[model samples]
Target: MESGGWTIKKRSNSSNDSLSREYVAETGCLSIVVLGASGDLAKKKTFPALFNLYRQRFLNPDEGHIFGYARTKISDDELRNRIRGNLVPGKGASGEQLEEVSKFLQLIRYVSGSYDSEEGFRLLDKEISKHEFSKNTKEGSSRRLFYLALPPSVYPSVCKMIRNCCMNKSDLGGWTRIVVEKPFGKDLDSSEQLSAQIGELFDEQQIYRIDHYLGKELVQNLLVLRFANRFFLPLWNRDNIDNVQIVFREDFGTEGRGGYFDEYGIIRDIIQNHLLQILCLIAMEKPISLTPEHIRDEKVKVLQSVLPIKDEEVFLGQYDGYTDDPTVPDNSNTPTFATMILRIHNERWEGVPFILKAGKALNSRKAEIRIQFKTVPGDIFKCQKQGRNEIVIRLQPSEAIYMKVTVKQPGLEMSTIQSELDLSYQQRYQGVTIPEAYERLILDTIRGDQQHFVRRDELKAAWEIFTPLLHRIDNGEVKPIPYRPGSRGPEEADQLLERAGYVLTHGYSWVPPTL
Candidate 1:
C-alpha cells in the first residue's frame, strides 16, 4: 500500500528467510514508542525528527503511529505545543510545512505513567494494540520500535516493563526492536550491567545502541571519501599523516544545566561517544563488505588496537563559574573539557596520534575531524614552514569537506599560501535539506540498520580505553584546571599539541560556511 510518498511494503507471513538490515524497517504497521516522551531529549530531538520524517513523506501518520510515554500528566495539546516550540523548520517552512505538522501531531498520543510500573506499560500496550488492530494486519506485518530517551539509571526497569508487559510475543509475524540512547552507562562495569539487563529482554538483533555522530552526513561519508576515492588510499596512514585530531567545541557552556552536566564530564558526554565514533570511521580498516556485522567488526578492531591513555597524555579543565549554578556542588571537580591522545597499537597507526578533543564554552561551536598530513619532505619554496596538507571534515553548524593545499600567492613574489578545495554541503547540494543527525538515525533504527549504531563489545572496548583516565579524575588523583567560561579550553591543550609536533592552522581559521 502506498502511504504518502513512501510505499509501505508488507512482509510475507510465512517467509523463512531473514530480512536484510535495510529491509527490517519496511513495514506499514509501525508503532514507535518513545519512552521518555516528555523529557528534553524527547521534546527537542525525538519529536522533531519524527515530525520531519512525516513532513518529508517518509512517514505516513495514517499508516504509522507515534506513542509518547512519560510520567508527566500532559494533555495531547500540551505535548504538541512542546514539540512545536523545539522544531524550527529551515527558512522556507510555509503553508505546506505548517499543515504537515498539524497532521503529524494527530498521529501522536501521550501516555502518562511511571517507567517502572506494569500498569503504565499495559496502558501503553493497549494504546499500541488499538492502533495495530485498527490496521487489521494479516500477520507478520506490524512492527514495534521502542526508543529509550530516559536516563541510564532507569534502563533496566524500563526494559523489564517492556518484556513483561509490552513486547510482541512472536517474531513469527512482526518483529520488535529497541533503540537505546547513550552515554551507554558510565564506564565498563556499568555498561556491562546495562547490557545484561537489556539482553535479558531482547536479543542483540533487537537492540540498537545509537550514537548521533555516526548519523552526521560527513561522518557517514567518511567510508566513501576514503575508500571510493583513490586520492586518499595511498596517503591514509601514519607514514603520510602527521597527526589526526577529532574536535568538538561548543561556544556555550552548560547554561544552568549543571544538574545534568555535572553528572558526566565532557569526556563521557562527548569524546567517549561522539568524538570516538568519528575516530573509528577515520581510522578503521576497510571492511570486506558493507553488511552491518562486517562494518561493526571493523570498528571493533579499531577500538581493540587502541592503548589506554596515560595520566600525562590527558588534559582536563573545568570552566569558571561552573559552581555558581545551584545544581552543581560548590567544590565539584567535574571537567567541562578534555584533550586526550589515543595511540593505536596496530602497525598502520602505530606512531600516529589520534587526538580526541572536546569542551564546553570554548572558542567555537563545531565538530570536525582534521587529518593533518606530514609536510613535504623536500621543498624548494624555502618559505616559512613549507605548508602541510590537511583534510577538514566538518560535522555540524554546516556539513562540509575541504582540504588545505599550498598554492602560489596571486602577487609577483614567488610566495606560497594555503587555499581550500571546498565541498560545503549547503553550496554543493543547494536547496537539499540534509536531515538532522537524530532524524537519520531514527529512520535507520526503524529500518533495523546497525551499521552506524554502537555494538555491545564496541562499547566495552571504548570504555576500556578510557576507564583508567576516568578513574583518575573521579578519585581525585588529578584535578581539572580552571579556565574562564567563554575562552578556548585550558591553555594546556595548546601546549600538548605543540609538544606532539602539531603545526596549528596558521593563516586560516577553520570556519563553517554560512548556511
Candidate 2:
C-alpha cells in the first residue's frame, strides 16, 4: 500500500521454506494477544505499533483480531478509552485518519486475567477462539501471537499458562508464537533458569526475545553499511579504528519506576541488551548469508569473543536525589549510570576497545554509536590537530549517519577544520515516517522474521559476558559514585574513556540539520 511517501508491500502469507517448518505455517487468521495489557509497555509501545500496522493495512481487519489480557478489570470499551488518546495520528490528522484510529481501536477486546491463574488464561483462550471461529478461517489454520510485556519474574508461570490454555488447537498449517520483553534475568544462572522454563513450553523458533534497539533504522542498516559498502570493509577493524563507543543517555530518571529500576541498574537495563546488540552488529564478521540463523550465528560469535570487563576500566554512578523516590530504598546501591570498556579477543578487534556507556538524568537524551578511525600516518599538512575521521550513527532524536573528516577551511588559509558528510534521516527523507522500533519489530514478529530478535544461544553468550560483573555489583563489592542529576555522569567515567584510548574531540559538535 502506498501512503505518504512510502510503499509498504503486503507481507505474503506463504512461509519461507528455508526456515524451520514450525514457523512455516500459512498466515491464516492472526490473533495478537497482549499480556499485561494494562501496563505502560502495552499502551506506550505495543498498542501504538499495532495501530500503525493496521493503519498501513498490513493487518487485515477481516482476518486479524487483537485481544488484551491483564489483571485490571475493565470492559473492552474502557480499555479502548484508556488507549484512545495514545493512538493519535501524526500532526494535522484528517477526519479520515481519525476514523481509521477509531476503527483500529474497535478491533481490540479486553480479557481481565492474572498471569499465572488457569481460569484467566482459559477465558483468554476462549475469547481468542471465539474470534477465530467467527472469522470462519479453515480448521487448524489460525495464527496466534502472544506478547509478554510484564516483568521477567512472571515469565515462567505465564509461559506455562500459555502452553496449557492458549496454544492453537492444532499444528497443521497454524502456529503459536510468544514475544518476550527484556532484562531477561539478573545474571547468567537466573537467565538460564528462566530460559529453561520457557524452552520447555515453546520451541526456539516460536519464542522471540526482542531487543528494540535491533529494530532501529541505523542498527538495521549496520549489515548493509559494513558488508555492502566497499569503503568500510578495510577501515572497520582494529587496524584502522582507534576505539568504538556505543552510548545511551536519557535526560530523565526513573520517576515512577524507581522500585523496578533499583533491582536492575543501568548495565542490565540498557548496556547488557541494547548496547551489546549494537556492538555485535559493529564487530561481527560478515555472515555467509542473510538468513536469520546465519546472521544470529555471527552475533553469537561476537558475544563469545568479548573479553572479561576490567575493574580499572569500569565506572558506575548514581544521580543525586535518586534515593528520594519513595519506592526506592534508602540504602539502594543501584547505579543509574555506568561506563565500561569491553575488549573483543578476536582477529578483527583484538586491540580495539568497545566502550559502552549508559546513564539516566544526564545532560541530554540520545543513543549513538561512534566509530573513530585512526590518525593519518603520513600527514605533512598536520591535519592531526583538527581531529581523526569518525563515523557517528545516531540511533534516536532525529536519526542520522554522518562521517567526520578534516577539511580545508573555506577561506583558502590551507588550514583544516572538522566537518561531516551528514545523512540526517529527517532532512534527507522528508515526509517519510521512519517506523518506530516497536513498529518494525512487531511487524517482523508477524512475518516470522527472527533476524532482529535474540536467539537462545546468543542470549546465553551475552549474559555470560556480564554475569561476573553484575554479581560483583549486586554483592556491594563495587559501589556507585554519586553525581549531580543534570550533570554528565561521574568524572571518573570520562577518565575511563580516555584510558580506553578514546580521544576527546574538543570544540566540535555535529548538530542534526533542520529542514
Candidate 3:
C-alpha cells in the first residue's frame, strides 16, 4: 500500500521563517475570494465563517474584504441575501450585531466568472486590487486567499487562472494561499494529478488541503489527551488496546443530494480521508515537537505502516429506497454504508484492527472513535462480567471524551457496573461558542497554520492505502447489500465486528452534552 515513482520529499513551504504567527495573522490586509460563491458550500460554510471571523474582529473589518466568484449572474444584494439566509444572527442578536452584519455585507462583492477563463479572473483581480490599494499604501501588504468551493472537475483550470491573473507574488510583506476541500481525487492517479496541478502553481505553504473533520475540537485535543495526560501514554497500543473503531453515522439520508454522495460512496466520502486521518493521529508515535511539520511527519509515518485493506474484511451496503432519489441511478450499487478493517503493520499496532465504519440514513447522526481494551489477565470478577475499559472520543452531536470504567455497584452486593470519567464540551465550557469546524479551519488558513491541513505526500499515502479496495467496489467486484433506511446499517456490519473480536456492548452509552 505504498505509492511508487513518488519518492517522499518533505519540503517546508514557509515563505518567511521569520514571520511570527501573530504577525502573519494581524499584519496583513486580507482578501478572501470564494470561487463558488453562489453555491451551497459557500453560503452554508465559507461566507458564514468569514462573517463570524469578522464579527469577532479576528479579521479586521478595515483590512479585510470578501469577493464572491461564480458562474451565476447575481447582483450584490442577491448574493448578500444568499449569504444572510445561512448566517442566522443567533437567538437574540444585538442591534450592534445587526449593524455589523450590514457592514460585513458591504465588504462582500460578487462577480460572475467562468472557472476556466482568464477574462473573468482578470475581472476578479481588479476587484481584489481595489481593496489592496485602499489599505495603508505604505504599511501592510495585501494578502490573497482563494477558497475553491466548486467541484474538483474545475480545480485545474481555476488554479491556473488564479496563478495567471490573481496572485500577489510581489507582496513580500503579505502572502497568497488557496484552500481546497476533499475528496482530494477520485483515486491514487487522479489525486496525484491534482496534487501536481496545485504544486505547480503554489508552494506547499500556499496550499491548504482542508479536511474539516480535523478542525473539530475533540480531534484537536488528541495531542493533549495522548501526551499531556499520562493515563493514555502506556496504554495507547495493541499491548493494552483490543481494537479501535471510528464510526460515523447520519440519521438522515442525502435525499436529493445523492448526486454527489453516489459518485464517491461511503469510503471516499468519509472513510478514506476523514476516518483514516483520525486513525493516524490516534496511532502515531509521539511527535518531537508541536510544530505543524513534526505533527504531520508523525501522521505520515503512521499511514506508511498501514497494510492494504482486504476485501474479505469489507462490508458494503445500500439503503432501501435510495434509488427513489432522482439523482441516483436506478441500478446503482454505490454503497451508502461501508465498514472495513485496516491493520497497521508496525510494532505499536501490529495485531490491532482499526475498524472504520460510516453510513448515511441511520437512527441517529453521531461520529465517534471507540477504543476497546483487552481483557484483564487476572480478574476477581469473571472476565466477561468485568467491563474492559473503553475510551470514546465523540466528534459530533456534541463533542466529548469519556472513558467507561468498571466500578463496584452502590449496593452491598460486590457486583460491578460501568461508570464514566467524562469531559463534555457543554458542561465544561459554559456560555462559550465553539466555532464550527469550517470556522476554525478557515481561521487557521488565514493565520497560516498548516498543522491541521493535509499534505500532498500524506494524501498520496492515504490513497495508496485504499485505491485497490476502491477499484474492487468500482468494478462491481463486490456488490453492496441492502439495509433499511433508518437502521444502524446492514446486519452484516454487526457480524463483521463480531468476527474481528470487537464487542458491541449494551447498557452503557455516554450522555452527550446538551446542544
Could you say which candidate leads in TM-score? Answer: 2
Say which candidate scores most in lDDT.
2
Model 1 — TM-score against the truth? 0.94
The candidates, ranked best first by TM-score, are 2, 1, 3
Q: Give the alpha-carbon lDDT of every model.
A: 0.84, 0.88, 0.84
* Tens-digit per-residue lDDT, 429-504, candidate 1: 9899888889888877776678889999999999998888888888888898999877888899889977766787
**Model 3, residue 104: C-alpha shift (Å):** 1.3
**lDDT score at residue 409, model 3, on the 0-100 scale:** 78
Q: Estimate each model's TM-score.
A: 0.94, 0.95, 0.93
Compute the lDDT of residue 167 as modeled in candidate 2.
88
Cα-based RMSD of candidate 3: 6.5
Evaluated at residue 432, the lDDT of candidate 2 is 91
Clashing pairs in 1: 140-173
Question: How does residue 107 of candidate 2 score in lDDT?
Answer: 90
The sequence of per-residue lDDT tens digits that candidate 2 reaches over residues 173-218 is 7789999999788889999999999999999999999999999889
- Please report the TM-score between candidate 3 and the true structure: 0.93
